[model samples]
Structures are given as C-alpha cells and as structure tokens.
Target: MTRWTQAAVLARMRQEIEASAPDPGDRLPTERALAAAIGCSRQTLRAALARLEAEGEIWRRHGQGTFRGRAPLGHPVRETVRLQAATPEQLMQARLLIEPAIAAEAARRASRSDAQYLLRLVEDGRVATSRGGAEEADARFHRGVAEVAANPILIGLLDHLADARRRAAWQREWDRTYRRIGVGEFVGLHSDQHQSVVTGIAEGNADVAEQAMRAHLLTIATAMRRGSDPADPGL
Candidate 1:
C-alpha cells in the first residue's frame, strides 16, 4: 500500500498544477476530485491545500472552490465565516499582532492632516454623549489610524476586524465587558490610552505609537477575557 501523506499529496498536487499551467485566479478542482486524481484521501488533500492557501498559491472563498493566486479584486480576501465566529481572545491576539505595527506605520507616515484627524477622533471618543456614541467613536478612531498608515492591505485587515466586531457573539462579549468597565473607567483609562496613542502619532514617534497601541489593546484584552477563563492570567 502507498503511504499517501499530506506532503506526498502536496507533491502530486504541485505536479498536476505544473502540468496544467494554472493561471492566476483560475479555479482548482474540488477537494474530492483532486484527492481522487492524486490517489490520496480527502483528509490528506485538505492538509496540502491549507499549506497552499497559506503560501498564496491559492485562496478560498467560503462557498467557492479554491482559486489560484491571491484573492481576486473586489472579492472577499478572507473567509468571513471564521471571523464571524471568532472569540474575543482570538480577536485580541490578532489585533495585538496587526494593529501595533499599523500604529507605528501611521506615525512614520503622519501628515498635518492625519494628525488633525487623529486628534479630532480622540477628542470625539473622549466626549461622546452616551455609551453607544463612545463605542462608535472608538471604532472610528482605530479605523482612522489604519487609514493614516496608507496601506491598502493594512486597511483591509482592519476592515475585516471591524466586521468581526459587528457579529452577534463578538458584540455580546464586547457589550458585557463594556458594561463591566463602566463609562467612568472608560473615560479614565481607555480614553487616556487613546490620547497617548494619538499624541505619539501626531509627534511622528513610531516607538511611542507602537507601545501605546499595544498597551491599549492589552487593557481591552484583559477586560474582555476576564472570568472567561479563570486560568488565562488575563494578559
């Protein structure tokens, strides 16, 4: 019997692709068909496909078959269903990995207009008339920072994160955490962190901007993750 492992399947799959001369954005065969052609089980073929997707040799749409190359123009860049179900901790980890770098980039690219916009956003978030208003302003502030970075890829990532926040599960956890924190704590803690981040951006200080953004995200993660897992250490 042949040991048709994931790596072996991946090799066969690549040979097929090379033979076919797959064009960018061309649709690949379905997993079952591909597996049959490659003489492998569906599970092994799936593992190989995941590697290809991560390497940008292919991309997947939720309901569509995998396609060659990066995501097509105007199509969803990521599988939105995953983000739609991500827990607060998962989102926090993603934000920690992504947003701090964008904050630093925004600092490096800061213009007079960018500084003014960030400052205005900070003030709006600070003085929001109600809890809902404050949350909206906070969302805008983060989105504005990604915009100031001036990178379409970074902006797209933040846009996906925003969509995640609108999902029912994410929103429920967010609302619970916000209620626990209360408006006074938001004004005292989170608002101050926002001011610090914008100040770093306005000053074009990349180090300060990154640090402030990381700290801000940490504070939020701590609040949302609290009691969800008693052993999580709330980091």
Candidate 2:
C-alpha cells in the first residue's frame, strides 16, 4: 500500500480504538486481526503500528502485544462550571475566575523579576494591539500570568484552558465581537489591572492584592455579560 493509504488506515484504526475504549490500560486488537479487518497487508499494518507506538498512543510488549497508552494529563474540573466547552462566553468566564486570582497570588508571591515580566507582558500587549497582533499578545499575557503564579498546578490548568480557548470557533467569535463592538479598549484595562495587582503584591499588601484581583475579575465578568446582551439596559 501507498504511504498515504497506510497513514489513513492507521488513523482510522486509532480512532476506532479511541471510540471503543478511551481509557488507558485497554488492550488493543491483535496486529493480524487489525490487518485483516482493515483489508491491509501485514507490512502496512506493521508500519502503522510503529507510527502509533512512536506517537506514544500505544505500546507493544515483546511477549504480549500492544496496549493502549495513558492519556496526557488534562485540566481537572471537580464540577460543571461555566465555559468548560470553550465557547466565547465560557472562555471569558474562565478568565474572570482564574486570571485575577493568579494576579493576586503573583502580587503576594512574585519576585522583582516576576513583576518585571508582567510589565513586559503589558508592554507587549500595547505594541501588539497597535500592530494588529492581538492574538499573540493575548497568549503572552496569559502565559505571563501563569509564570508569575509560580504554581505548577495553576500553570497547567491555565495552559489547558488557554489551549481550549484558542480553538477556531472561539477565536472567530471573539474576533467578531471585538471588531463589531469596539471592545479593544479592554486590552489597556487588562494591562492596568495586571499592574495594579503586581503593585499590591510588590508592596506586600495582601488585602489590596486580593481585593484588586476580585474586583478586576468581577469587572471582566460584568463587561462580558453586558457585551453579550447590550439590550439588557440594566448594564
């Protein structure tokens, strides 16, 4: 079989394996059985199996055969929360909850270099926004927050959330809203909030840091709600 056809067959097999049992430790069908099922020669099947093993999706035991591999660690959510599926509304809600707290923690724990990193993020955001580089700036800002938090768990969670939020659907919706509604001003406001939180932390004012963080998040939530439903008039 051609290389492309072998790759396609491998992908299909992988999808089937995933759909059948997503959990790790599940046994995969034998190579001969899979080859027969897919109507592919053993050579093509072996090539596909090698690829899957290299990708860490499966492991072959010299004596026993191939088994499913462990899934990569992912963000943990103990309960259902707003925006878990990465809709625009959900992404904003997640940011409102996580980013401010990250800022507050940074303010309480950040070293001088941490503070400088944040300032640099703000500066980058300004330049990027001006140069129509909002997406890159946005990512940098969030990554800076994760760095400042200095907690591996929080960093991992934020990284996963950021990844999900960057999906095409969410980006399209976010860009549409920003373009249609002149919402880019929030970029500067976000920078200011970050600075305020960093200042509070650098000054060793834990109370100020916490309060500023909470207020900043609430403001984001309120703004998102208002923008989502401008006709509410109550906003």
Candidate 3:
C-alpha cells in the first residue's frame, strides 16, 4: 500500500473538487465519503479541506456541510445566479441605503439576547484567521442585524445584495483589491468596525447604531475605492 503524503492527498482532493464541479453554494460530500473515495484518512481529508477553505476554494457553514466556493457576503450565491449582475458601486450603494436602517431598527427592537447574539458575531469576526472566515462572519453579522429587526422584506432584499458579492466578476475585482490592500489589515479594520456596530446596537441607541453602521460601510467604500477605480471600464 502506498503511504499518501499530505501534499499528495491535498492535490488529489483538489482534483476531486474540480471534477465534482460543485456550484458556489453546493455542498461537497461528507468527510467519510470523500476520504474513502480518495483512500485517505479522515484527518488527512480534514486538513486538505481546511487548506481549500483558506485559499477561498470552498466554505463551511456551522451546521451546513462544506460549500464549493467562497461564500458571498450578503446572500446565497444560488439566489443571485439568476439576477442581473450588479456593478461594485451599485452593490455598495444598496448596502449603504439598507444596512444603516437595519442597524437602527435592530437597536430599537433587539432584546438582550439579541444583543448577545450580535456580540458573538463580532467575536467571530475578530478571531477569524482566514479571509473566507472573516467574510462568513461579516455576512452573518449583517443578516443577524436584519433578523433582529424582524423585517422579512428587508431580510430578503439583503439576501439579494449578499448574493451579488459572489458574482465571479465581482469576486475577482474584490480579490484584486484585497491583494493590493493586504487581507490582514482589511480584516482587522473590519473587525473593529464590527465591534462598534455591535456596541451601538447593544446600547439600544438608534442614532448611534445608524451612525456606526454608516461609518463602517463608508470605511469599506473607501477601501474599495482605494483598491479599484470605479470609473475604469476594465473593472
């Protein structure tokens, strides 16, 4: 029997992911099955999966199985697949309009438990070591705030916005920008802003929540602008 090196195992697993050709939101098979199919131990398979996730080749939800590609910021990629693609500015503008209001409403309506949940999301963002992990927390934080507002209409709308982030063109642009801006710095800045938003919501100050969220979005806009000139036809 051949002793499979971890690097070799990882290469094989990646080939499988490509061969399977799962859509962005499609979940891969269980570890046991994948390991069996690849003739590797579960521990080896998990390591390969972790590397794939860190490289933004795949994502994992807390309860959901591992998904095939980078998770979108706002909505499931499947939801946005049929919708018309949005420009980066359009996506940012939509968030500016919707998210601040959601934060304000959450401040007014959130119970103590709800505030705790939001804080937990903040902590998740702070501790995230990979771009995909930070992004997952970011998406869940926004969705969590919307959920706290108890507005289904806004929730559905936000999902569309989230899904837009997963567009191949959009992700490529974001990736290019982040490569220029430094992913670690970007994640750190985002984590700080996340804490502010949570604090504003937990304090039940609608104005504070609105301002915090607006400021946070503006900071992100600034980073995006710094990374890519919106007027560039190539973008």
Candidate 4:
C-alpha cells in the first residue's frame, strides 16, 4: 500500500475523476467514501476537494454533494489558477506585496480624473447597503488604483488576484468574519479603510498611499485570521 500525502492524494483523486470522465453534472462519492478510498483522513480529503473547486475542476452545493465542473478553459492562462491555490493568509500576503506598490505608483502617476473616480468609489462603498455592494465597491477601488499605475503587467496581476477573491473559500471567510463582527461594524471598518487609501492617493503622496494600503490590508487580514480556527490548515 502506498502512503498518501496531501498533494499525492489530490493528484490521484484528480486522475481518478478524469479517467472516469463523468458527465458535467455527475456527482462524486460522498466525502467519507472518497476519503476512505483515497487513503486519507476526511480533513485531508476536504482540503484537496477545496483546491479542486478553487481550480474550477468541481463545484459543491451546500446541501447537494460535489459535481463535475465545466470543461477547463483552453486559454494559456489556466496556469494562473494552478499557481493560486492559496489560503486566505496567502492571498492576503500576495495583496500586501502587490497593492502597496500599485498604490505608490498611482500616487505618482494618477490624473485628477483618477483621483475623483477613486473618491467616488470610496463614497459608494461607504454608503453601500449590503455586504455584496460594499465588496464590489472595494474591489473597484483597488483595481482602479492599479489602473492608475498605467502598467499593464501590474494591472493584469492585480486582476488575477481580484479573481481569486471570488472563490467560495474566500466568501466563507468573509461570512465567518461578518458573523464574528456585526455586519454594520464590518462595513463601517472597511469604508474607513477605503477612505484613507483614497485620501493618500488624492494627496499624491506615494509613501502615505503605500502605507495606507498596507495598513488597510493588514487590518482585514488580521481580522480574518483571528476569526479562523488556528488548527485549520485550510486557513
């Protein structure tokens, strides 16, 4: 019998599914059965499944079991999905590395029009009535700052990072965070953070913009990590 590590288990599971070639909506075995067959604990199996879901290889409905996903994209950029099987902390780290520099560049290069557009997004976020509305405004604000940087490569990288945010796991994190912190409070905190970032950019202060962007992301990342179980490797 072969000892199965997490990566090996994940790979083998993918291979099994591909070889079976289930129809698009076909359901897989129950999690327990799958774990037993794969020679992994249920916890390990769940992590592998989550990664596959993130990669668009499968989809899971809450009450229903997992089902086969649409065919993978033929675009060469499928590599991006494979490279980004990141936890919440890892995604936050990537943003911390990427956004601060974009903020600084936007400060230097942003036109008055760019500043106004960002300010509008900040205001939109502040007044947003629902969580989804606020999240969209926040995304637009960050992506707008990246746009102001006028570097297509940076813009594309940020676009990929933003796409990662739409993953089901990240939504679970936000929902968990909201349950821990009241929804109103969560929205208010994010609004204030967005305001600070907009102010820094409007002032055309690169250092200040970078600092604000870093601080904003750090605050959310810390809150998210705190809300998560310390022992959960999936986090």
Scored by lDDT, the top model is: 1
Please provide, for model 2 over 172-234, each residue's C-alpha lDDT reduced to its tens digit, 9 standing for 90 to 100: 555544653443555667657756766776775666766776776676556555655647554
* lDDT tens digits by residue: candidate 1, 81-172: 35533566788899999999999999999998999998898888778777888888888989999999999999999988877676555666
What's the CA error at residue 126 for candidate 4, in Å?
0.7
**lDDT per residue as tens, model 4, 144-183:** 8898889999988887777667655576777777666655
Lowest summed lDDT window (length 10), candidate 4 = 75-84
Q: What is the TM-score of each candidate against the true structure?
A: 0.64, 0.54, 0.62, 0.68
Query: Can you list the residue pairs that collide in candidate 4?
Result: none
Clashing pairs in 2: 83-90, 107-201
Instruction: Give, for candidate 2, the lowest lDDT window spanning 10 residues.
Output: 77-86
Candidate 1 error regions (>4 Å): 1-78, 227-235
Q: For residues 102-136, what per-residue lDDT tens digits would candidate 3 score against the true structure?
A: 99999999999999998888888878887888788
**Scored by CA lDDT, what does every candidate get?**
0.79, 0.64, 0.78, 0.75
Q: What are the runs in model 2 whose C-alpha is more than 4 Å off?
A: 1-86, 130-132, 180-187, 230-235
Which stretches of model 3 miss by more than 4 angstroms? Answer: 1-83, 230-235
Best TM-score goes to which candidate? Answer: 4
lDDT ranking of the models:
1, 3, 4, 2
The TM-score that candidate 4 achieves is 0.68
| RMSD of model 4 against the true structure | 9.3
Clashing pairs in 3: 74-162, 75-162, 75-163
Ranking 3 against 4 by lDDT, winner: 3
